[model samples]
Target: MVAETTLRPADLIAPLFVREGVTSPVPISSLPGVSQLDLASLRSEVAQLVSVGVRSVILFGIPLKKDPIGSGASDPDGIVQVAIRELRQCFGEEIVILADLCLDEYTDHGHCGVLTPTGEVHNDDTLVRYQEVALAQAAAGVDLVAPSGMMDGQVGA
Candidate 1:
């Protein structure tokens, strides 16, 4: 009790990994108890978290279809966007929903940014992609967008 630290359920932000086109939640052996959730499992897990007083969550999406431009990152019907809308409709403002804005998971090559003809990361081009992804997340009722791509000017842009 001597520690000057205060923690509550609100302070805990659950990180969810959601996979597109999955019929069931997939276990992530590397993450111990964590699993990549399908839409149904995601809803059930979030409900359980809310029942236990957790009021915040951030989502990462794994698209079944990855492209060079990571087009799914900004698609209104993308996995993350759909998940965000579903959560918002189910929980409304009772919980804070955040989206992890990045293209790595949606890119076939697993790079965080768009590539040049020489196969190098194109910074400026990737910024535009980030903007599109951010806008898409906003339109999906996300309370916050966490740009985890480690790109320069990501927050400022």
Candidate 2:
């Protein structure tokens, strides 16, 4: 006899992009059906997911500002952090919330971490930013934090 297993909505993880300062949802060309959502739109989208029995999501943030050190990534009121709080309040353990922890989108350089004077990535410096981001996400009550740092030995750092 063979045992059969099937995929279900509850096991799927939806990736949502939250962009700061957006009043309306903006389509992402690379992702045909996915859009960078404003906070209001984000709530709506997650609601639909819950209705469909989707129990988990991962969020990526696009902040309104970009600086050399990615200050917004660790800011308490940053887009992703704000989303985490809102979702937690509304969902309250009904769904799993994960934050995509990275600085690529928050930094003007668009690199995962800080760069050195010679334009090479400064690993130690970038890890500091990641630590701050992880802390902020934890404080916001995220269920999980996945680093998008794209660096070798990121966890060890």
Candidate 3:
């Protein structure tokens, strides 16, 4: 009857993967019990999380369009931005929404940032992209933006 540590639902932050142009939730082979959800599914899932006291969530997006600049990463109408807007409209302030600020999922080469001609990651260039992403997330009503990946000067940028 003596438990040294206690775990609560509120202590957990659910991570949700959202894919563009998907009609149904697609199961992730690598992540057990997790699926890439569509817009409708994402909304439902967030509602469920709030119902259970899981008040925080981090969102990752799989965009339908990818480019060298990963333009979708900072688009106001991007998948993550769209999700944030929907979630905010759905739950208001009942839940905290955090976006996974990265370009890997949105980049054609799967790199976290723009690459040089020799295929090297451009830290300074990437920082500018990160700034764009941060601004987009902030405009989308995201409670926080967690910069993902190992880009230099990311947190400060």
Clashes of each: 0, 0, 0
Which portions of model 3 show Cα errors greater than 4 Å? 1-3
Top TM-score prediction, candidate number: 1
Off by over 4 Å in 2: 1-3
Tens-place lDDT digits, model 1, residues 117-148: 99998988999999999999999999999999
lDDT of 1: 0.95
lDDT for position 14 in model 1: 100
Per-residue alpha-carbon lDDT of model 2 for 1-157, expressed as tens digits? 9999999999999999999998999999998988999999999999999999998999999999999889999999999999999999999999999999889999999989899999988888888788889999999999999987887667765
What's model 2's overall lDDT? 0.93
lDDT of 3 by residue, 1-157 (tens): 9879878999999999999999999999999999999999999998898888899999999999999989998999999999999999999998989999999998999999999999999999999999999999999999999988789899999
lDDT of 2 at 153: 65
| Lowest-sum lDDT 10-residue window in model 1 | 1-10
Query: How many backbone clashes are present in model 1?
Result: 0
Two-way TM-score contest, 1 vs 3, winner:
1
